[model samples]
Structure formats: C-alpha cells, structure tokens
Target: MRRYAEVKTANMLMAVELSRRSKGQLRSYSLHPGMVATNTVDKEALWPAFRQLDIVTSDMKPKENGFERWKTIPQGATTTVVAAFDPRLDDKAGTYLVDGNIAMKEQVASHAVDPVCCLLLE
Candidate 1:
C-alpha cells in the first residue's frame, strides 16, 4: 500500500513534468477513481486488510456513507470519458480530475506541485 501511494504520486509528478516539457503540444492528467466494484477488488482477499481500518463498505453502493454511491466498473469510467472528450478540460491540462471535473484548489496537495520537492524525484 505504501508503494502504491508513492508510485501514484510519482506518476502525478511525471504527468506535470511531461506537460511542461511539451509546451502545449501535449497534455497529461491524473485522477482518482474513488471505489469501483470489479473482479480485481476481491473482497475475500481485501476483507482482512480492510477489517483493520473498519471503514470498508459492504458490497453495495450507497452503503451508509452519505457522500459517495459506489460505482460499477462502467459507471467508474465516467471521469475518464469526460477527461478524454470534454472541451472544458482542454485548458486544464496536467490537472487532477475527480468525478468528471477538475478538483478544486484545496483538493490538490500543496507540496505536490512544489518545484523544490519535485527535485527529490530526480
């Protein structure tokens, strides 16, 4: 899990670097898919790990949590679909998308975009 998170952060940083180097000729993005139910999400295997955290929702959407209704695999693709085709996002390259829109300012990590911290990745 630690490695997973580190790799995700690295990928986000790389997307920013790639976009910057391309100088408007290309674009890149990062996203959070939230939780999606699929074959890959083996409840049996994950149950033990999640049991420790105690926030695991049942195998149902809208499970007790008021904010999110867990999405099906197809439903989970909406953000990607929008990111790929949405004209509104054309000006928003190298940004993080959540729920089919650019995440708000506070939604982004302050240190993630810092050039000083980015140097450590090299």
Candidate 2:
C-alpha cells in the first residue's frame, strides 16, 4: 500500500502539472481518506484475532483491524468530497490532503510529487 500510494502520488502530480500547463483550466488534488468502517473487510476473520490482541469490541461496532479507530464511511469521504468540490481549494491545486487539511507527515508522498519524480513518472 505504501508503494501504491507513492506511485499514485507521482501520477497525481503529473496530472496537476499537465493541468497547470493547460492555463488554469484544470484542477487536481491528492486526498487521503482515513481508516473507514466498511463492510468489505471480513469481520469474521478480525473478530477471532481481536481477542488475541486484547481488543475488546461490542457486536454493535464493525471491527476495522488495520487502524486504532475507524471513521464512518461518510466521515471518511469528507476530505475527498472537499477536494472535489470545495471552492476554497481553487488555489490549492496539487496539494496533498488528509482529513480535509494539508498532509504534513507525508514524506514519501511529498517526494513522489517532486519535479524529478514527476518527470520520471511522465
């Protein structure tokens, strides 16, 4: 997934550059949705393992194993929807966002968006 994100970031940067060369006619952004609680993951598999990890959960909540906590699907979509439609982002093209804010801890992703990486990606 880390490698996938790195490559995806490079591609996004390339698109942003292309958009920029289009003379302000296009927009692009990279958005990260936090861990979301969805039904796609096999809850049955996670349930048995949670007990070993000392994770206690009630049956009412879905177990999303990879992260400390899970956001509802709508909650996870906040950043993506914002990136897609927010007028405030008119000047924020090529920005990498997480949770509807700039992502500051994304060293690998930042490097992927660098000019050299963008060129290679081209």
TM-scores for all candidates: the values are 0.77, 0.67
The sequence of per-residue lDDT tens digits that candidate 2 reaches over residues 2-120 is 55566777666775676566666677777678667676344675665544443335553544563556788899999999988889888767777778876676433457556565666
Q: Clashes in model 1: which pairs? A: none
Task: Please report the candidate that would top lDDT against the real structure.
Answer: 1
lDDT for each residue of candidate 1 in 5-57, tens digit (9 for 90 to 100): 77777767776776777785776888877667565445477664444444355
lDDT for predicted candidate 2 compared with the true structure: 0.66
Model 2 segments beyond 4 Å from truth? 43-68, 105-108
Residue 116 deviation, candidate 2, in Å?
1.9
